[model samples]
Target chain A: MSFDLGLVIEYFPRLLSGAGLTVELIAISSLVGICIAVPVGLMRVSASPTLRNLSLAYVFFFRGTPLLIQIFLVYYGLSQFEAVRNSVLWPFLRQPYWCAIVAFALNTGAYTAEILRGAMQAVPRGEIEAARAFGMSTALLFRRVILPRAVRIGWPAYGNEVIFMIKGSALASTITLLDLTGMARTIIAKTYAPVEIFLAAGLIYLAIVFVLTRAFRRIEARLNRYLLHESA
Target chain B: MFDLKGFGDQLLLGALMTVGLALSVLCVGTILGLAGAIAKLSKSAPARFAAETYTAVLRGIPELLIVLVIYFGSSGLLTAAAEAMGHDGFVELSPFAAGVTALSLVFGAYATEVFRGAILAIPKGQIEAARAIGMNRRLVFLRVTLPQLWRVALPGLGNLFLVSQKDTALVSVIGLEELTRKAAFATGFTKAPFTFYMAAAVLYLTITSVTMVGLHLAERRASRGMPGMRG
Candidate 1:
C-alpha cells in the first residue's frame, strides 16, 4: 500500500551493473550494425543481380522473424552442429556474449539496410548525374554525393534504431546474459517486487530513449538550418 | 537426429498455437488500437497524452521486456492487490493471457500509428463534401472517413500483424507452449535441439512468407481506384 523508497534505493546499486551491461551490449551491436548495414544497403541497390538478390533475401529473412527466435536459432541451433564444434568458429560461438552480439548485429543490419535503402532512394537522382557529368568516379560519386544525403535522410530512423537496439539487449537475458532486464528479473524473484524493479528498469530505458530522441532532433535541426535561415 | 513422430506433433501443435494466439491477439489488439487511435485524435488533451505515452512506452521497450514485465510484473501487482483485499490466494496470469497482452500492447502501439496516419490521410475536403450533403459528424466519419482510412491502414495493420505473429514466440520466455517453447521442450526431451529448432524456423518462415502474399493482395485490393498509387 505504501511506497517503499528505501527498498528501491537499496536495489539501485545492484541494478546499476546490469544497466552497464545493457549499454555495452547495445553499443557493440550498434557499431557493428552500421558496418553490416552500409554494405548490405549498398548491395540491395547494387547493379549486380547476384549481390542484390542475396542481400534482399538476407534482409527479408531477418526482418521477417522475431529477434528472440533468431537469437535462439543462432545460440542453440549452431551449438547442435558438429562441424561448428569441430571448426575454429566454436571458440567464438561457444560464448553467449558473442552469440548475443552476432544475433543483435544481424537483426539490426536487416532493419538498418531497409532504412538505408529508403534513404538511398531519397537522394536526388539529378545530383548523382551531375556528379557523373563532372567526371566523378563511382567511388567519389558515392562518397561525396550519395552517402551524405542518405545519412541525413536516415538519421531519424537510425536514431530510432539505437533506441531499438538498447531494448533488444534485454533479450540477451534469455541466453543467460545478465543485462538490465535480466538483472531486474533476478532481483524480483528474490524480493518479489516486480513492479518496482521492472518499473525502474523501464524508466532507465525511457531515459535512454529520451536522450537519443533529443540527440536526433538536434541533428535534424542542424541539418535543416539553411532552410530555416532562408525562410527567416 | 530427427524425431519424426514427435516433430510431427510438435510442429503441428506449435503452428496451431501460434496462429491461434496471433488471431486472438490480432482481434484484441485491433480493437484496442482503433479505440486508442480515436482517443489519440480526440479533442481531449489528456486523451492525447495517454495515447502518445502508451505508444512510446510500448514501442520503446523490447517485446521481450514487455512480456517479462506483464508476465511477472502484472502478476506481482495483482497478487499484492488480492492480499490487500484479504484474499488469501495467488493470482496467476495464464501464459496465453500474458502472450496476448504483451503482443496486443505492441500491436496496439503500432496500430495506433497506422490508424492515426490513416485517419489523417483522409482528405479534409471529403469531410467537407459529406457535410455539404448534410452529413452529421458521425456520418462524416463513418461514411466518408472510415472507409478510406481502412484502405490506407490495411497494409500497415497487415505488417503489424505479421510482426505480432512472430512476436508470439516471446511468450516462450514464460514457458508458454507456443512454437518456440514447444521446440525448447522437444529439445529437452530429445536432447537433439537442431532438428526441432530447424523445423520451427521453417514453420515460421512458411507462415511469414504466406502472410506476405496475403498482405500484398489485401493492399492491392484496398488501394484500387486511388490516385497516383501505382506501387
Candidate 2:
C-alpha cells in the first residue's frame, strides 16, 4: 500500500539493463522500416497507377489493423504451416525477436510511408520543374531535390513515428522478449511490487521520450537552418 | 482449409465487445480531452501546468504499462482503501474497468492536443462577436465554439477512434476476452493460430474500414456549406 522508494531505486538499474534491448529493437526496426518505407513511400506517389494502388493496399492493411495482431500473425500464425516450419526461414522465424522486428518494421514502414508520401507530394512543384530544366534525370532529381526536401519536411512526423516505435516496442514483451516492459513484469512477479516496478519502468520510458524529443528538436532546427536564416 | 469449429460466434461476440469498449473509451476520453484542453488553455498557471503534466506523462508512457499499472496498481489501492474503511478482504478492480480507465487516459492525452489545436483554430473574432452579442461564457462556448470545434476536430477524432479500436486489442493482455483474446482462445482450442488470427484480422479490418467510411461521411456533413473546405 505504501510507496517504496527503495524498491524503485534498487530495480532502476535492472530496468536500465532492459532499456538496451528496447533501444535495440527501436533502432533496428526503425532503420529497416525506413528502408522499407522509402521505396513503398515513393511507390505511393509513383506515376504508375498500379504501383500507387499496390502501395495503397499495403499501407491500408498494415495501418488498418493492430500491431499486436500483426506480431501474433507472424510469430504464431506462420508456425501453423508445416511449410514455414520446414523452410529455411524457420530458424529466424522461430525466434520472437525477429518476429517482433519484422512486425514493427512493417507497421512503422506503413505509417512512415504515408508520412513520406504526404511530404513528397508537398514538395514545391517549382523545385521539380527547376530540376528538370537543369537537365537532371529522374534519379538525380529525386536524389538532389525531392528526397532532401521531403526528408526535411517529413523529419518531425518521422520523429513522432520513432517515438511511437519506442512506445510500441513494449509490445515485444508480450511475445516473451525481455524488453523494458518484460523486465518490469519479471521484477513485479518476483517482488510482488507491481506499482513500484511499473512506476519505475514508466519513468524510464518518460526519460527516453524526453531525451528523444530534445534530440529531435535539435535535428529539426539543424535541418531547417536555411529557412531560419531566410526568415531572419 | 480453415475451420473455426463453431467459434465463429464467439469471435463475433468478441468483436462486439471490442467495439463496446472502444465506444465507451471514446465517450469518456472526449469529455476528459475537452476538460484537459480547456485546462491547458486556461488563465491559471497551475491548471495549465497540471494539464501539461497529465498529457506529458500519459502520452510518453507505453499504453501497455498504463494497463498493467492500472490492473495491478488499482487493486492494491482499492484493497488499501477498503482496509482503511475496516473491510476484511482484499478488493480487486475488474479488468474491464481497468482497461477502460487506462485506455481512456491514453486516448484523452492525445485527444487533448487535438482539441486544443481545434479550439485554437477557431477565429478569435468569432468569440468576441459572440460576447458582443451579450452571450455569457457558457453560451459562447456552447453556441459558438462547440459546433466549430466538432467540425475541425472530426478528422483527428476519427483517427483516434480507429486507434482506440485497435488499442482495445491490448486490453486482452489483461484478460478482457476482446477480439484478439478470442482469437487466442480459439487458437488454443483448435491449434489453428493462423486461421483464427486471420479471422480476427479480417474482422478488425472490416470494423476499421466501416468506421473509415462513416468518418468520411461525417467529415463531409460537418464541412457542409463551408466552401472549399469539403474533402
Candidate 3:
C-alpha cells in the first residue's frame, strides 16, 4: 500500500557490499575473458582447419546454452566428479566466486571471440596483402597492422559487450555470491519493500553502464578521427 | 546415479511448460515490438518520445531486473491502481503473467532495433521502379520491398528469437515453472543439484543445436536466388 524511503536507506550498507562484489567479479572475469578471447578469436579466424574447428566447437558450446545453466554445471556438475572433488581443485570449486568467474569468463570469451573474429576478418584483405608485399614478417604484420585495426573495428561492439558483462555480473548473485541483485532480494525480504531497493540497485547499475558507454564513445571517437581524416 | 524413472514425468511437464511460456512470451513480445518499432519510426514527437523511452529504460536495465521488478513490484502497483479505479476485488498478477510481461518488454526493445534495421535495409531502387510502373505504395512495398526484406530480416529475427528463448530463464528468478526453475526446484528437493542442472544444460543445448540446423536450412531456402552465396 505504501513505500518507505527510510528502510531502503537502512539496507544501504549491505547493498553497497553487494555492489562491490559485483564490480570486483566483473573486473576479474573481464580480464580473464579478454585473455582467452583474443586467442580463441584468432583461432576462429585462423587459416588452419584443425585450429578453426576446435575454436568453433568451443564457441558453439558456450554460446548455445544460457549462462545460468553453465554456471550451475560448473559449480554443481563439475564438483560431482571424485577426481575434481578429491583433487586440489575442491577448495576452488567450494567457492561460489570462482564458479561465477569461470562461467562468466568462459561465456564472455565465446561472445567476445566471435566479435573479435568478425572485427579481425573485416580488416581489409588488400591491407594485409600490402603488408605482405612490403616483406614484413608475420609477427610484425600482426603487431603493427592486424591487431590495431581489429581493435578499432571491434570497439563499438566491444562497448556493447561491456554493457552486457555489467548486466551479466548480476547473475553471480544467483550462485549466492551476494551481488547487487542478491542484496536487493535479501533487503526486500527483510524490509518488505521490493520496488525501492531494487530500483536503487538498478539505478546504480545504469549509472555505471552509462559511464562505461561514454568512456568507450570517447575512445572510439579518438580512434575514428584518424580514419575520418584519411577518408576526407 | 541418475534417478530417471521417478522425476521423468515431472521434468517432462516442466519442459512442456517452458516451451509453452517461451511461445507465449514470443507472441506478446512480437506485439509490443511491432508497436514500438512503428512508434519509433513515426514522424510525431510524442510517438518518438514514447518509443525511445521504452527502448532506453528497457535496454539500460538488465533483463533480470525487469523480471524482478515486474514479478515483485508490479502486483502492488496493479492492486493500488485497481482500487483507484473503483474495483474492490484483488487484481492478481500471477508469476507466469509477470514473467511474460518482463520478457515481452525486454525482447520488444531488441526487436525494435532489428525491425528498424530491416526496414532501412529494403532497397530504394526497387520501390522507385515499382512506382514508375504505376504500382501504389502498398502494392510496391508488398511486391518489391517486402519480398527481398524477408530474406534480409530472417536471419537477424531468427537469432533474436533464439536469444530471447534462452533468455526466458531470466523469469526463473520469479519462480516460474520453466526449465531453469524446474531444475532448480528439483535440485532443492532431490539434493542432487548437479544432476538436475546438467539435465537442464543438456536440454538447452539440444534446443539450440536443433535450432541451429533449422536456421541453416531456412537460410539456404531463403537465399536460393541470392547472388553471392557459397552453399
Top DockQ prediction, candidate number: 2
- Name the TM-score of chain A in model 1: 0.93
Per-candidate interface C-alpha RMSD?
Answer: 2.2, 1.1, 1.6
Candidate 1, CAPRI quality class derived from DockQ: medium
Backbone clashes in model 2: 0
TM-scores of the models, in the given order?
0.92, 0.96, 0.90
Candidate 2 residue B60 C-alpha distance from true site, Å:
0.7
Single-chain TM-score of chain A, each candidate: 0.93, 0.96, 0.94
How good is the docking of model 3, by CAPRI class?
A: medium
Worst 10 residues of 2 chain B by lDDT: B222-231
| Collision pairs in model 2 | none
Model 2 chain A poorest 10 in a row by lDDT: A187-196
Among these predicted structures, which one has the highest TM-score? 2
Q: What local lDDT score does residue B136 receive in model 3, on the 0 to 100 scale? A: 95
Error of 3 at A191 (Å): 0.8
The alpha-carbon deviation from the true structure for residue B201 of candidate 2, after best TM-score superposition, in angstroms, is: 0.9
Q: What lDDT score goes with residue B176 in model 1?
A: 80
Compared with the true structure, what per-residue lDDT tens digits does model 2 show for residues B144-222?
A: 9888999999999999999999989999989998999999999999999889988999999999999999999999999
For candidate 2, the per-residue lDDT at B161 reads 93
Q: How close is candidate 3 to the true structure, as a TM-score?
A: 0.90
Using lDDT, give the best candidate's number. 2
lDDT of 3: 0.83
